[model samples]
Target: MATQHDERAAPVPCALTPREERRSDLVDALRDSASVGLGAFPMGVAFGVLVVHSGLEWWWASTFSGVIFAGSLEFLFLGLVLAAAPLASIAVTAFAVNVRHVFYALSFPLHRVRGRLGKAYSTFALTDEAYAVTAGGAGRTFSSRRILGIQAFVHLYWAGGATAGALLGSALPAEVRGLEFAVTALFTVLAIDAVRAGRDVPTPVLALGCALAGRLALPGQMLPAALALFTACLLARYAWTRYTRTPYARTRRGGDHA
Candidate 1:
């Protein structure tokens, strides 16, 4: 009877332990962040080299990477600082450069993150690369732990690269001609990947149109003007889609009733 009962018993389900789950999350985050890190590290090294060439101490690279964490803005800030620009001018420039982040916030999955501190850090670390990775289709299903881990890894890559570059800057050639292009190259690659993944030609076309319009109309304020025009166009598209869909939906319902 005991042998028969054992044969009839259900098999136990296996589950990952908390430690194992955390390890898995870390691995996934590292894998996902590798591409971004590749770009960020070199860009960081370039920034550090520029800092030393610009006569700033090595520590300034680390400080900017850790504190500001905005790649493009950091480069601009370095020049502004060297020129002794007014604080108000710096603040305005910072706002204009980073205003696109406001749109990023609309779609970022902050609610999935657990702790208050985690959310705060996530918000602070929402770089373009991070947003691109986390807002992509594959990233939509990622856990909060994985998302945070990816950001942390990318931050480390930038910080470490900056420190290394600062140490090596004194030995390198003064010109360092092509290092400045790393960030631009990285952005181009990211934009290409985004276009391929989305397979949406019209969006890029719309963006290009807006950019041209901004350049022609508001040459002095191209970035902000382009962003504003693109945003308005997107909003208009959304409203039109909703309006068209509502009547169709109601028509379908009415047809079903008839």
Candidate 2:
């Protein structure tokens, strides 16, 4: 019963959409995330080089990249986490900013995933970009190999890029200082692509509405607020559909597909 993610182009529903058995587009997407890491790490390295003159070695930055797994938020919170930001504040911020994820969980049909690890990693791989790819419905693969591969690819890319930047930051020039801006630009394009999809209208609207509601009602409770709004709407829609079915006219109306 396994289907390839790439086979959606055809109605047969057996082939995965990964293009090839071995290649991964998820890794390809990391080209952007990697650029962000490389650009930022060099700056951090430059700072370390200037202050301590030896440059950042490792341990700290790599751990941050691996564990934190967020780019902008990681940059902003690295210092704060090291400083005194309450754990609650960090949690609140994460929830509020990422509240839209709750909506994503709605349409994801994981019923076909086979084992515990497959399901676990599939959910784990569901990052912002991963979710975009999934909800974008690029290729429907019942086998999660490519999906999990994508996550692993991005994870490796981040670690490698950060390590490279941290080590080379001091030796790099100053004009390349703001390269991190490219990641933001890339994501802007991704956002535009997602908006143009047309099919995502319902999801995005629900996400935007929940976000607004969270800003007003929950403020710091982004995750909970988003979940509440999305759940309420989903439940309401389900109830309406369940209770209000239109009776089909038995008489010939349009005489066809109607």
Candidate 3:
């Protein structure tokens, strides 16, 4: 009788339904992405304004933001497209500009995202802001739903901002001078935040050195050259660190056994 009473009084587990889970995930995503969206939306607006000022149709802004979905690259790509840059040059430029994403992929939580379509979209949507948000310590344990929701919200913010800017560009000044600086400002903020989070001095020092070297060696092509040099240096450092750690780990284990 006592056992029966105990069982009757025990609370039942209350699991969320699928719909509720999705709704909760969306709300959490909105909250997590709010800060990033604040910056991205304005940068995107800047891109759209530039697109219209450059004499392209307003729809082109949405097309680039939605299709390319790369904030920095889209800005550069607009110039290349307007200049009628050769396909080969454009291809090379795109690779050089985005090579850093390869490193980003090494640490991004791609495994947490499920479904082939979901993974594909997530990959396509992987921006600096997304990486910064999801790769942080607090974001390490984010669920698949939350990850997808973050990316989706950010994407919407960019696309929507671009559209709004394009539509409003005509009403604004004929010459918008500082709009182009938005991308640079956004990148600087992200870099600072990353440095703060990691507290890794060597990485930024190495990057600065690479940038200086690239500027000195190839002033016209500094960006790509700097990125290549930085990547090589990072790979070498990773290899050396791993090689050195293995021996110490083995030695520690041996001493423990002895």
lDDT against the true structure, each candidate = 0.82, 0.57, 0.82
Model 1 score (lDDT): 0.82
Q: Global lDDT for candidate 3?
A: 0.82
Q: Which stretches of candidate 3 lie over 4 Å from their true place?
A: 1-15, 173-201, 215-224, 239-258
| Candidate 1 structure quality by residue, lDDT tens digits, 100-171 | 888888767777777999999999999988887787666778899999999998888887778778879989
TM-score of each: 0.81, 0.57, 0.75
Candidate 3 residue lDDT tens string, 48-130: 88899899999999999998888878889999999999999888878877777877777789889999999999999998878
Give per-candidate clash totals. 0, 13, 0
Instruction: Please give the distance, in angstroms, between residue 63's alpha carbon in candidate 2 and its true position after superposition.
Output: 1.6
- 1 against 3, candidate with superior TM-score: 1
Quick one: best TM-score, which candidate? Answer: 1
- Candidate ranking under TM-score, highest first, comes to 1, 3, 2
lDDT of 2 by residue, 157-234 (tens): 665555555555566566355665655665566566667865557766886788788788877666567677878886
